[model samples]
Target: MIENVAALAHGFAVALTAKHILFMVAGVCFGLVVGVLPGLGAPNGVGLLLPLTFTMEPVSAIILLTSMYWGALIGGSTTSILFNIPGEPSSVATTFDGYPMAKSGEATKALTFAFLSSGFGALFGVVVVTLLAGWVTRFALLFSPVEYFAVFVLAFASFIAFGGGSPLKSVVSIALGLALASVGMDTISGSMRLTYDVPDLIRGISFLVVVIGLFGLGELFETMQNPAAAKPVATRLDLAGVVRAALEWPRYGVALLRSAVIGCWMGIAPGGPTAASFMSYGIGKRFSRNGPRFGKGEPEGLVCAETADQSAGSSAMLPMLALGLPSSATAAVLLGGLMIWGITPGPTLFSERPDFVWGLIASMYLSNIVAVVLALATVPLFARMLQVPFTITGPIIALVCVIGAWTVAGAPFDLWLLLLFGAVGWLMKALDYPIAPLVLAMVLGDRTEDAFRQSMLLSGGKLSVFFASPLPATITGLALLCLVVPLAGMALKPRTARSAAP
Candidate 1:
């Protein structure tokens, strides 16, 4: 504990320097713009700015990108709270309750809660990162290919059960992600597995291209097509509401803690903030007096969902930083960003480059506070952006998506892939296939495949050897349960429905 404290102290000294703080502020400022604009997410924004960092010192570059990451994560809640749009993927659930509060004329208060609670949740998560990343890193390093593959199986199971609509369709999307993973040349052998004719296929589809198409590009198309779907203009808030939210802050302390706790658990588990936010909102509704009229405009629901989503987002950084396992699409891009900068994130990162680790850890604290203060100060300005017409907004979204995609590789091929995935994403949304599972599958597929093959080779092609290891046995068992629970639930559905019938 003392050593960790000492490290944090040193980190603060390094991070609080004027030069570093200015860079951190710049990153936060950039991230807020990225987060406010539809179709310009954290990953794309960071990826676009990564090259510019190459000329700077490694630590500064990391601080900038990582702060941008936290800023974007924090800024996403603003849109979710004020407009029904989620500026980023993780904030999607915040819209369930946040927008209602805005319509009810609690826009300033809702924005306040979102920003402050996000700061609280981020602190909770960063504390965990400081105290627990070492242990988590050790554990992560112990996993082999078979273990990772099993974990991947567990990851996909959630979509099957909760993806909504046809389970088969979700499964198909997962399969498609796996297929896309196979497009790259075989790493072990020189021979290509599925790259038909194109040389770009040799490296396979870029995850960023895929994500941009599915999210930014795809959403742009959807917005343009929905000509009749006009966005509601939000009214400006007086300064009084901000003060009111602060005065009521003490009352919601318990709820904030509750949401943060739930968010951490959800982040660490296979389920994500989408689940966490709804779960927290449900609890608030059941317990709070205003629960009955939650959708009609209630602060409790807004507080619950916003806090949970931000908390979950903050905690999601842990798996990626310590274990080299990205818990979300944004984290995956972050992982890629770290690699681009030649900073390999994992156990060795702490030991080999304490400056980078502590600097980043320190930046989290600085950025979290900056995000809250900046968001609160700028909420009024951001809230006005909702007034942009669909024609204008839709084209800007397309432009950002195209530019982000093109910047990924500076290749026309990536633009083509973006167009392709945009179409696929539209189809997936239309067909009710969950995009989350597809992203999870894409990010983990390569690692899982590598693990599976390595495990087979290690076992001398005797697959039974996989069951021999305790970790493998445990992971496989859990994965089996993940798969079985959905089927079992489906099987029991009819009997329960019949029994409940009058």
Candidate 2:
């Protein structure tokens, strides 16, 4: 540990140079723009910047990319809070409470809570990476397809059990998402399952397009239908509110810690930030004293979702760095960049290039701090955007949604899909169906199916294979508990009330 600390100090020296700091600022600025624009996510941002880094030194190149990642993460929550649109897939959970909070005239508080918690989560993840890198790498290596499947199941079960709605309705929402996810050609079967003779369907639907339709266009439609709702709600962006929100951080200590732990675990494993955010939000809803107000502009919910999302995104870098396994799409791009730079990832890389490794880690600390400052500075700008007359902002949002949807694949077909799903989203909201579960299912459905099939193949169709190992068995057991306990509580609730009746 002492040696790691010493090396990290040297790394800070490497990352603190003027040239590297400039790169960090530039990367963060560009990334914020990428993140605030739907359909242009971190992975794409990193990929676009990859060619530009080809001439730079490896450490400088990496610091630039990673800084952009932090900036993108912080920026994504801005749209989720103010516009009910997620600039990144992992920001979806933030929209649940963030938009509601902003709509209730607390945009400053929501943005402040999100940025502060995000900074905390990123720092927590970096601390883990600095201290426990070796242990986490080894633990991550223990996960097989069976364990991966179990983890996905556990994520799903947690959401369903604690999602705070009709369990049956949640199930229905999940089923719809899964069905939508399966529209493309089957990965293993080499045949189309749901294309139904449509060539465009062969490539499947983009999750981003669906999200834009559901949250962005859908919200627009609702407002258009009710002109009264189109009137901009009063919102203030003041230093006082930001300071007050920061001061309230201590009140949510439990949520911050829990979410950070969940994010790190999911990042080290294969759950990714999207799954981590959803799982954290679900668990937060169940455990928070403000549980009943989760979907209704609760600050605790914003803290939980943003904390887990940022932590997971940051910790995901560890596996890509130490084990040659990319835990997320952006990490995969970073891994590619490492390979391009002639740096082979694995246990040996740490010993072979401690300077590079530690420098990247140190940069995470600095970059996240920069991201938070820049993100906070923009809170007022985004808050004031909400004050724009709906007639103008609404059309602009719709046009942005349309452009975002078209950018998914440059296919005209996605435009129609956007409108269809927009109407579907409006209908679902009207019927009071939970949208988060559906989004979660859509995100994990394909990965879960692939993992499950691989596990089945390994076990030759025997279900006992999941229990053949301690890790998978424990995770599967926990998933079952998550499913059963909440349902059992619900079942007993009515009985207990009857017994206590006068």
Candidate 3:
């Protein structure tokens, strides 16, 4: 503890410099812009800014990038609450209750709760990263191909089992994602699999393209279908109402703790904030005394979802800082940025560059505080954005999506792909299919395939190799349980119904 404290003090000394503070503020503001925009997300935002940081010192660049990440995570709640749109994937759960609250004229309370919970969760995660950095690094290094594959399996299985939609529809969505993911070349053997002789297919579909298409353009298309969507929502700003909501925090003590833990765990697992948010929201709703009120503008629902989203975003840095492993797409981009800056991120990062390590950690704490304050202070301005008609916002979002998609690889083909995926998203929504699992599967698909192939090669096609290790064994077992439970229930329903009728 003493050593950690000493290191943290050194970190603060480094981070508190004037230039670093300025960078933090700039990054936070930029992140907020990215979050408020419909098509631009954290990964794309960071990617766009990453090149600008190339000439700067590694520490400064990282501080700036990570603070932006913090801002983006918090900023997403703004759109989710004021509008029924999620600025980023992780904020999707917030819309369930947040927009409902806004429509009912409790926008101020919902926004305050979301930002407050985000701040609290982020601080909790940073503290965990400080104390458990060493432990987490060691544990992450223990993961092999088998373990990685099992983890992805667990992620998909959990989503399908707990997604609360038609299980068949969820399966179809996942399968669709996997099939789309396979369109690219086989990395291991350099063999062509699904490329229909198209040059664009050779590079495969980019995750960013899909995300923008599905979440951004898809939302725009959906909004255009409803004439009522063009009308401005009724939103009121009440600082007093915010205070009243804060007083209810004590009642949600258990939920807060549970969500924090869940978010931290998913962060370590590197499942990304999106998964953590959904899982936390599901768990919170399952156990809440006000269960039925969860999606109906419940304050606790916003708290639980936002808490997990923030915690996951913060803790995701742990793996990247300590073990050179990135838990999310944004972290992966940051990893690339670190490499570009001539800093090797791994176990040696702490020992070799203690100042850098600690300073970045310190910045995380500062950034979280700054992000929350900015979010709250700007609530009225952000809430006003909802007053704009969707007719105008829709075209603007479409343009942003086009611009963002083109920037991914500077390819015109990405724009075409974006439109195609957007159409898929619109169709899925019309059919009441859940998009979360599909998105999750697409993000993790490449990793899953790579790990499974590597494990198979190592084991010479022996399926038993997956169960050889304790961690993989446990993860795979849990996955099987998640998958089987839903099927078992479906199978037994007929018998139970017949017996009850008799």
Candidate 4:
């Protein structure tokens, strides 16, 4: 381990190259800008900048993209805390406590907590990715199509598990996403399924455009319905005071450590950052002495949520780089970008492209440090963003969504798709349906379907082939555990209730 650290330390010397450093800076700046805007997420930021990386080397490209990822992970808390609007999905839980603290004139403390927790969580992610990457990669190789499909089912199951108002509504959202993913030409048969006589539909709907519209444009439309509440306004806070009172800061070692662990596990579980953040927050609240303070304004809860979010954001890269599977939406976009660059990611990638992998690992460390500096330096400026009335801000958000949707395909058709998805998003949101399932489906639906069919074909149509291998059998056992245990608990609930009633 010490030897590995020393080698990574050497990698840092390379990360500090004059050119890579500049890209890191650019990423940090761009991240802060985009992360402050409600509904605009890290994936959009990377997609917007993807074309610019065409001329750069692979190492530089990874550094630039990963730096932006880290920066946005840090900067997202600003909007959630001060404006009660999540700039990224991962930061959504932050609003529960963060905004209330800001409303009570503790914006500076909240921001400071966010910055420190994000850096700590990200560092933890870097360490996990560096040390356990090989083992994790090997574990991923065990995933056949059935296992991958099972994982997808579990990931989408979060919609029902987390859905607050109605399980049926959550199922609806997941079904919609799966339906959208079904559009376009079939990769296996070369047959168009749902083009509806349109050439663009033949290629399929880019999830990028749909995400931008649903989360970005849809947010704008939703906010417009309640214009006054959507209004943003500046608030005053004393950074100096917060720093001076640092001794009074919450004791967050346990929270930070716990959230990091939770984030790492969730990232590996394939549910992504949204689940990590919310899960961490829920756990923190459950364990807190002042659990009731969670949504009302609790520093401990803020630290937990923010830490887990950034950790999940950072660690999600591990599966993408090592296993060639995206653990999050942003990683999925980067996966596309890597494909465009003709880079096939997997264990072989580590062997064939050690420099690229090492450089990326090095860049993440530097990016974390840079994010802290940038977030702290821009606090005064970002704090002012809260003051901009929703009336002025709403139009800007809508315009950015328009640009984002248009950029995905360089066509007007995508913009219309944006509006359509935006409506869908708004409706799902209104009905308390979980949005993560839709994104997860849009991401893994096709791959899951293809894998199942291919596995059957390779086995000569023998269903038993899925369980013939040791790896597959073990995976089956786990899947059964995942499904059966949950149902067992549900089934036992009424029996326990009956006994208690007697």
Give the TM-score of each candidate: 0.89, 0.64, 0.77, 0.86
lDDT tens digits, residues 1-502, model 1? Answer: 5677788877887788898999989998888878877667776677567656757777888788777877887788887777788887667766776788777777777778777777888788778777876677778788766776666676677657654445566678889888887787777786787877888787777777888888767666766666544354355656787888878865888788888888887776656666777788888888877678777666667777777776776677777776566655666666666766777666767778778778878888888899889888877677776566767877777877788777767888889898999898877776667776777677667766877888888888877765788987887787677677767665768465335423
Candidate 3 lDDT over 1-502, as tens digits, reads 6787899999999999999999988999888877876546787677567666778898999999999999999999888887787878789999999989888888777888898899988998899899987676566567777887887787678666765566667789888878877778887888987988999889888766776677666766776887344222544556787788778666777888889999998887657788889999999899888778999999889989999998988998887776555666677667756866888766667778988999999999998999988888776666666566767877876887787777667899998998998898778877768775665566556667988999999999998987887888998999899889877776778455225421
For model 2, what is the error of residue 215's alpha carbon versus the real structure, in angstroms, after optimal superposition?
Answer: 3.2
Summing lDDT over every window of 10 consecutive residues in candidate 3, give the lowest-scoring window.
227-236
Whole-model lDDT, candidate 2?
Answer: 0.79
Per residue, candidate 2 scores C-alpha lDDT tens digits across 1-502 of 7877988999999999999899899888877876775435676567556656767899999999999999998999988887787877789999999999989889888989999999999999999888987676566567777887887787667666755455556678878988998898898998898898999999987665676677656656876776342222333468898899889877899999999999998787656677789989999999889888999999999999999999998998887777565556567567767866788766667778887898899999999999999998875565465455667766865786787667656799999998998898788776666665566566567767988999999899999998887889999999899788867776768455335423
Assess the local accuracy of residue 156 in candidate 2 as a C-alpha lDDT between 0 and 100. Answer: 65
Across 95-170, the per-residue lDDT of candidate 4 in tens digits comes to: 8999888788777788788888888888898899888766766676766666665555555554455433344555
Find the 10 residues in a row with the least total lDDT in model 2.
227-236
lDDT of 1: 0.75
Worst 10 residues of 1 by lDDT: 493-502
Model 4, residue 407: what's the lDDT? 61
lDDT of model 4, residue 54? 62
Alpha-carbon deviation at 97 in model 2, angstroms? 14
Best candidate according to TM-score: 1
Q: CA lDDT of 451 in candidate 3?
A: 87
